[model samples]
Target chain A: MIRLDGVGQVFDGREGQVTALEEIDLHVRPGEFVTLIGRSGCGKSTLLRLIAGLLPPTYGEVRVADEPVTRPRRDVSFMFQRPALLPWRSVLSNVMLPVEIEGDKGRAAYRDRAHELLELVGLKGFEGRLPHELSGGMQQRVSLCRSLIRDPQVMLMDEPFSALDALTRTELSGELQRIKMELSTTIVFVTHSIEEAVVLADRVVVLTPRPGRVREVVDIDIPRPRSLGRNAHLTEVAEISGLLHGLLAEKEARPVDEVRP
Target chain B: MTDTKRSWLTTSPVAAVLLPVVGLIGAIALWWLATVVFGIDSYLLPGPQDVVSTFLDQPAYLLKETGTSMIETVEGFLLAIVLGVPIAVLIVRSVILERLVYPLLLMVNAIPKIAIAPLLVVWMGFGQWPKVVMVLLVCFFPIVISTAQGMKSTPVELVELLRSLNASRIQEFFKLRLRYAMPQIFTGLKVAISLAVIGSVIAEFVGATQGLGYVIQQSGASADTSLAFAAITLLSIMSIVLFYGLVLLEHLLLPWAQETR
Candidate 1:
């Protein structure tokens, strides 16, 4: 569904040019859930922006379903770490935002769908309440409902659960998995948590620190509707976790620009 | 009863009335004591009783002038809100426009509004229009500044989240940015209301034949200190009333914010 060909991002800092990512090539299939895992400043977010078409890549091409992405695609949606609910709007209104903006012709058309999305996200009675009135977890849920309102083909989530508490994060992770199953939409999730990557993604693509490049892609043999606590895939999870730990430690030992060739 | 107690403490009705009432009583007591201890001339510092008597004696005149002043204040204030909010949004949306126009706005704001009163009178003539323009000038900057700041200060995470959802720029502005800016916009409105009164007074001081400012100026010339004080007191009353009106609106429109605050 999405492909990045030799994509690179460079920042023209006050000091000098800083490369965030270099020679990044990847292909994401339809209905695939891919999580990008790396240390802070590994350009995971930069890569997500490239896919979202929010920023132009300084090098190479980013394409969605064979079309070059020059700008944000209508069929792709992005989610962020923060809930980012509008404090002044009710939950229902927030969810209805994309429809309203797209001029979806009639309000009645989107109303039922919005309600269903809210119900799916477990925010039923909260339709009348404003964002600030809800708890942080609940606010994030509203954001999730909002993102899913458009039913985009691909969902790009950048550390969507990182700011949430452990319990809420766990809950949302499970919910996301369920959502993936129901919708079967392609998703590219970015996170720092190894457990989060393992629990939520089919393939965890690990990258090295700044001037980020793919170190490895670890496939999770975990079955659907997976839980963090207990699963038949716990042993596989541990093995992947151990592998990621080794990569991280090795990367930390070397200077950022020094490759392990 | 404990639940009621909790509700009492948590709600705005009790705190709003109690705090302000206490403050007013304290202020009145100080004023009365100061007059008594200093044996201040009633002409220089009329007691609350004297000011009340002035109001009682010329109720019709005070009411008429107050009504005129309020018309000018409110008309100008509403215009400022309409004009300021859009300009603020534009400034936030376009960096080039913001850089070009914001400093100009700041320059206009920095000029003591009192100085511009004469210029406005000269341009608009010694009529109600000048006073209205004056009020607009004084009240406009804070509204624009607060609104622009409010709009710009939208949480980065929320913005990123919206972008990830493939929300168009216009969608992000109206759905997320505007809603987020509302509480701060109300802050601007409250500030503008008080300044509106001041602006009207300044215009009256410069050139006006009606309104509370005119009443105060005319009373000053006649050396009727009590009447001038009466006009001043009425001005204060108008200011307080307008301010609370905005507060009431914030309560109605943004109950969520009020609850959180």
Candidate 2:
């Protein structure tokens, strides 16, 4: 459902031009859960931004649903590391924000969907509460509901559960999998954690740091409802996680000319 | 103290009200004691009772003057919000306007407001216009600066989320930036309101026949030290009331702001 062809991003920094990403080619199938993982300064988030159309790629092109993405499209939604909720709005109001922004005529229908999304995320009684009243996990769940409110064709999530405590993070990852089973939306999630990438992604895209390029795309063949603890697929999860860790830790001394893949 | 008792003292609604009152009474008692012990001349520092009696003697006149000052302060504060918020929006929306107007705003804000009080009176005459203008001058900077800073400080993720949803510039602003900046904008408003009161008084000090500032000025000329003290007390009361009024408003309007930060 999404394609990036030779996409690159160059930022003008204080000292000189900083290439954030380079010579990137990626494709995400419809209903696929693709997670991008890399160390800091890897431009994983930059790639996501290019696809979201928040920032145009400095070179090449991005297409979603076979259309060139010159700007943000109506069928895609993005979520962030932080909950980023509007502090003055109640949870329900915040979930309805996208609909309100679109000035959609069927607000009542959207409102009902908002409640259902909130309920799906186990936030049934929090419609009247503000973002501050929620725990970190709960707030992120609210954000999830918000992004899902429009029932977009694609959702781009950047480290959505990384800010939570370890237990809450695991819990949320499980819940995300459950939610994904019920919704057909394609997802491109970015994360720093190797375990998280293995747990959530159908394919994990490893990216190199500094002028980021796609290093490897590892397809996860593990079954659904997979767990990190005492599960049938624990060995597979550990194997994939270790491989990603090694890839991230390698400090290759390749020449600049040889760096491009 | 018992744990529950200590918690009650810290958290009880009654304690919140009583503690400040006790502090005020203690402050008044210290002042009364100092006057009696040092045998200080009433001309220099009137006793609390002397000030109270003076206020009692002509409550009607003093209240009328207070009403006039209140009118000027409210008008100027409202005007500042009306003008300053839009200017802030304009500055945030366009880089060219921001660069052009930012330095000019800073230059205007840097010139001592009191230095311009006389000029305001020269331009607008001895009527309420000068006082209102003075209040606006002092109040404008805080509102504009805080609002601009707030708009600029919106989390990058939130902006991207809006953009990814295909929200228009106007929707991104009203539905996201404006609402997100509210807590900081209220911070500016609180600062401006206090300055608003002081600004009106400063204008009254330069040339006015009414207001608490004028009353204090008149009392100074007549050597009515007790009356001056009464007027000063009223001024402090006015400042306190206005500040708390805003606090209450913010609490009611943006209940999420207090806990989110």
Candidate 3:
């Protein structure tokens, strides 16, 4: 339900224009879990922003639901690297934010849905507690509950688990796969962890850093209800991971002048 | 670790109340000794007991003056909160407003508020209006600066998150930005209340018929140093109470603010 065509982004650096992305074309089908993976500065987040319509691309188009994205759509929810909960609000109130911002029209209606989502994320009793009162992982789960409460068409996550510890990250990634299976919502996630991408994503879009360009797209054909153990099919994961690594290594050996200066 | 302590002085409601009182007693003891050792005349610096006697001797009159000062302080502070917050919103919402007003704000705050007190008396006349205005002047800047800083500091990711939901500007401001700014605004308020007390007192020093400021000034001229000391103590008490009042309000209103920090 989302597409980007020949997109480019240029940020005004102190010296001159610094290219963040260029000639990037990506298409995501509805209900698809797509992960964009690359080293830092590969414009994974820049691409996410384009899809969210947070910034106007220097050149090209991003569209969702076959509509040219000019501004943020109410049907798209964005999750940041940080949980980004309002510290002054209770966990329940923070989850209810989208409902509150959209107004009272059906807020009373969504309150129950919010509670259910919190329960889905294992944060039921935490509803009355503040965000900080929760652990970092719990806080991010609350953020996930918040993003889903709107029944959004697309959820864009920018390195949501990057700041988390390894155990928490792995645990959350496993849960995210289950959540996706249950919710059946489209997600375009950004992350650096190959294991996380392998576990959660149906397809991984790898990009070249510095004027980010789509280097390759690796499809994970592994069967679902996937996890770090049992059903993940680690052998298939390892082969695909090695292939992706070779693609990155090939470029790293070259040391392209464009990337450095 | 501190929570496990059972000592009466450190573990109960008594501990919470006793610590500051102990500090006060120590300070009083030091002052008493200083006066005895220096053999200073009471006219120059009255001992703590002398100040207490002044308050005890004319309790009704002193309290009446305190009431007047309290009215001025609260009014000025409330007005600062009401006006300063909105002005901060305006500054944050518009780059033009921020550009035009921010430097001017710095200039206004930089100018000694005491220097303006005499001017206020000249224009506003020898009445409570001058004192209120002076308090507003002193208190207003910190509120605006801190609130604007808070609003501006609303994480870019959160802004993008709200934007992804297509929240209206008003919705973004009221729901996200304002709440994000609460702890910071309270910090400004805590700082400003103390300044507001001083502002009103300074205004009173230039010209006023009532308030503890006027009482202290009157006592100074009459060489009633103990009375002046009492007035100063009342002023300090008012300042401490006002500062802690904001702390209490912050505790009640933004319980979540304390956690993340």
lDDT of 3 by residue, B17-131 (tens): 8898999899999999999999989989999988898899999999999888988988898899999999999998899988999899899889998898889888989878888
**Candidate 3: residue pairs that collide:** none
Q: After superposition, how far is residue A57 of candidate 1 from its true place, in Å?
A: 1.9
TM-score of chain B of each: 0.88, 0.94, 0.91
Error of 3 at B79 (Å): 2.7
What is each model's TM-score for chain A? 0.94, 0.95, 0.94
Q: Mind giving the per-residue lDDT tens digits that candidate 3 earns over A67-134?
A: 99998888888999999887777899989988888778788779999998888878878899877788
Q: Judged by DockQ, which candidate is best? A: 2
Q: Which stretches of candidate 2 lie over 4 Å from their true place?
A: A253-261, B1-13, B33-45, B94-99
Model 3 is docked with a DockQ of 0.69
RMSD (Cα, Å) for all candidates, in order, is 4.2, 3.4, 4.1
Name the lDDT value of residue A65 in candidate 1. Answer: 82
Clashes of 1: 2
Ranking by DockQ: 2, 3, 1
Worst 10 residues of 3 chain B by lDDT: B2-11
> How much of the true A–B contact set does each candidate keep?
0.57, 0.87, 0.85
Instruction: Report, to 2 decimal places, the DockQ of model 2.
Output: 0.70
Cα lDDT of model 1 by residue, B90-209, tens digit? 988899998999889989888988878888877989878998888889889989989988888778877766775566777777778898788899999998999999999888887788
Candidate 1 chain A lowest-lDDT run of ten = A252-261
Q: Write model 2 residue lDDT over B1-261, tens digit each, in one string.
A: 555456666889999999999999999999999999999999999999999999999999999998999999999999999999999999988999999999999999999889998888889889999999889989999999999999998887777777777778888888888878888999999999999999999999998989988998899999999999999888888988999999999998878777878
Which regions of candidate 1 are displaced past 4 Å?
A: A105-109, A252-261, B1-19, B22-41, B93-107, B116-123, B165-168, B259-261
